[model samples]
Target: MPITNADVVAVFSEIADLLEIEGANPFRVRAYRNAARMLGELGRSVRTMVDRPEELDALPGIGPDLAGKIVEVVTTGSCALLQRLRKELPPVITELLKIPGLGPKRVRTLHRELGIETLAQLRQAAEQGRVQSVHGFGAKSERQILEATGRLLQQERRYKWADMEPVAQALLADLHATPGVHRAVAAGSLRRGRETVGDLDLLVTAENPGTVMDRLTASEDIQRVLEQGVTRSSVVLKSGLQVDLRAVAPASFGAAWLYFTGSKAHNIALRKLAQDKDLKLNEYGLYRGKQRIAGDTETAVYKALGLPFIEPELREDRGEIEAARSGALPRLLQLTDLRGDLHAHTKDSDGHDPIEAMAEAARAHRLHYLAITDHSKRLALVHGLDADGLSRQIDRIDEINASLRDFVLLKGVEVDILEDGSLDLPDAILGRLDLVVGAVHSGFDLSRDKQTDRLLRAMDHRCFSILAHPTGRLINERPPCDIDLPRVVRKARERGCFLELNAHPARLDLSDAACRIAKSEGVLVSINSDAHSRLQFDSLRFGVSQARRGWLETGDVLNTRTLGQLRSLLAATMARGVGQ
Candidate 1:
């Protein structure tokens, strides 16, 4: 199989982490990190651009050397420098960096001071209070480390949905194209749009099970054939993703899909429901004493059970069964329902694209409006905008808006909520913009009450519109902060402010449960792309998936409204007795 963009990005990222732990040159470390980000932001796969040296070199962060390394990784599946670094550092040391509270410097400190190289050793040190004695880590930080380590230890290895999607798509396409295969789909957690998937459950309806199995086993992507049977087969992909392929008869395809696509709890409840109806439910079909009542289609199966067809994303046994039976199933939010993206960056910040390009791309993506919410000055590394810079950008947006047709670029800033709960930009400038998106970029380790209070104070600020990326999390990289989310959601509702579901692959914060909380509190959510580049507008699909999982409807989303209606809603957040 060909190398994917994710593959190259992963290697480069790991190299950056390993190099950081090794105390390599700071610039060298930044180069690797920047290259990884560049590759990740590139819409096209680096694999496709490998042959075009000029194209690779033209990327914002890529130099000739890094470009060559990217090409090397794509062509050869590995890099010699990364391999040498891996050899120099124990593999376990890199794994420590994954624990939330532990960064490269802290990992180095633990290794150098306590000779800790593994989670177990780190745990031992924490328990023995050795961690508190480290220069930077105190008692509270030590406790956090222990807690984070415990979570990491219990967690199973899983691949991010973004990373596994291409693999699943390519595999399903290949399977469906097989001569005897009639239909194919990736089921299980993947179907549910879980943040990460442990393994792939594939369902196939085939005319000849033998031929289908033969083709699957013969695929080049198969690193190992775990099993091969007439009705079922299992294989391990080159990337270590295990796939279980079940060949079903056309008549049983629906039942098979349901059984495999299930959350185990959901299936158990469904089976019980079938049992109550004096029927037996299995992968083959629903049976009433050897007579099949339903199996051919999912709708038939659901109808026979006296329940509406529960969307795959809602089949989590989270009262969906009861809701379906009572006709309370929500009209789940769809991608088409999103009218705009409330949070996006431009070249004025760390973003790769200019404001015009980002707006055009969002328009091309079918959005009616987009907010140019570039970072504020507190984020020095991104060269975030100060008051003067934001004023200039606002004027530029106005100039651009005058020329646009059918779309509007909302003047906005991703203003940082300082550690003390104050806005980074002055009220003079913030008042000039259409909206302000307050974010917590630093001071993540504050106590729960303090963090919640900090956010509440920021929401009290007259200009605060949406709380961007609520519960500061970076997917698998960082755990969410210690703030009380229920309290935060309630506060947002009271303040007439909204929260953002950042759609960036790295930071899909304000998680499914958070979205549900916001929904119940009548606090609308902005399913924003948080796009740093034109291509990133595509990330809205992931945000939409998360929203559907949270049971959000079009009305629950802030950006789903038309421009005129949206402005009315935004104006409410700025109302504070007409005071600064």
Candidate 2:
């Protein structure tokens, strides 16, 4: 098998753990960890260049010795030293090193004295008072261990944007309702439109900061008060969420909100531009010499810099300043620009709502049209529809359309693209649908070449109207699959297929960079929520933000067109394929 960087990093991390357990030199162990990180971030596979180990040595921290070891591992399946160490040590002992507050020495002590090999055994010893009876582990240490063990066991993992949005909205509501609070808005990663937020940050403009802070600290939802100051407070929610509230004066609210709602790189670039123009930018406000220039809104601040306002999502230091300066900033698509939602599920699949309920929700949102893109038959867990089931759904849609005076519902299928790049539903089934969203549900680990080919072939399908979340990445959890995104975008454009900027935060696949490249290549994008539930439809804001970040305009997005216009575009696409 061709070794990936992840494989190399895992092996190196294992080595580092074993070395630390052996009480090896700290720097030597640190060097290995550093090398592992360097290799993991490399754009190209290190294994492919194993013959010339010097290429590895040229990387920041990797030296001749480490490079030689990399070569050894690549040439053979294992390294002699690592294999010898593995034989001498029990794998269970190595695992203990992963627990928090228990480093190598502590792990070795637990193994030798307490005879503990795993977290469960260690927890049992702590609960039974055996851990406290040990010389180094006092009652306090025992309690700490039990707590850490519980934390490790109950770790809920990171929440996707879809998962975290409700929590954030609840917190915002609480903050807004609190006495002395004038206004409350979510800032930081949440506002910057990041797919996965490290924590929720709410900025509050309060008449009395101390009272607001006290109210927040005393809230029933707070699990622990991490920090409290007169103007700022941080707390951990009972649900393993960290929330920070910063109180600001009404006068400085805009600047504070803008500063905190930063993609740090974007702020840094803005500051540099301000400095060059003999101005100062900070959380307080924009200043020229000693006088405050703009302190109320982001637009005012940008205007002070002699530029049109930049959207928060595009504030990522990615040429926004130059684009603003040139007066050529792309007219980014907005939530109101979308005429329809193309990817939505109902009880027809695994969705919680019925078709009429989903339609009502879309109508409430004033959407011109909505597509019921339920899963195809391959996703059995989702109760994916076969041809018969789909035909029934189409009949229901037609009935609903006949009854409705407004808001059209289109017959669509989110068809699975099998590993071999073939649609789950054949052309016969696909040809009957108004829309088809081709997506990859499994075989995520295919090699780059295979994965690219799979998607490219799927795009060639006459029924493939849109490529959904092309890379299949979950932010901070799964990295993008090995597919050349630019090439995929190019293929989609050439094939007259729109690429989806999936709005469900966790899977903002075909991310901002891919969106920009796709637009440049003449590919249209659809800002889709991929909403499975009614509440999740609001995630379109994130999708709009992502599209704005890519400088996408109404012209570049399929949903930006009116219902009639979109139908014409689809008809034209079909006609083009037929003519070819």
Instruction: Evaluate all candidate structures by whole-model CA lDDT and list the values in order.
Output: 0.88, 0.80
Model 1, C-alpha of 429: deviation from truth (Å)? 0.8
Which regions of candidate 1 fall more than 4 Å away from where they truly are? 51-55, 112-115, 125-142, 217-225, 576-580
Best by lDDT: 1
Separately for all candidates shown, the number of backbone clashes (residues 3 or more apart, or on different chains) is 0, 0
lDDT of residue 55 for candidate 1:
91
Q: For model 1, what is the error of residue 110's alpha carbon versus the real structure, in angstroms, after optimal superposition?
A: 3.8
Among these predictions, the greatest TM-score belongs to: 1
* Per-residue lDDT over 1-580 for candidate 2, one digit per residue giving the tens place of the 0 to 100 score: 2344555666787788788877889999888876765554343567668877667767556789888888887776457778877887766676566454577888877777878878789888988999888777789889978877776666545545544555576667777777878898888876766656778888888788888788789876678999999999999976567889898887788888888988889888889889999999999899999999997887888898888988777777888889899997888787998888999998789775788887887877778899999999999978999999998998889999998877899889999999988889867777888888989988887899999999988888777788998898866545578998888987877778789999876677768788899889998898887877554577687788777777889999989888888888776665544210
lDDT of 1 by residue, 268-345 (tens): 999999999999999999999999998988888999999889999888898899999999999999999999999999
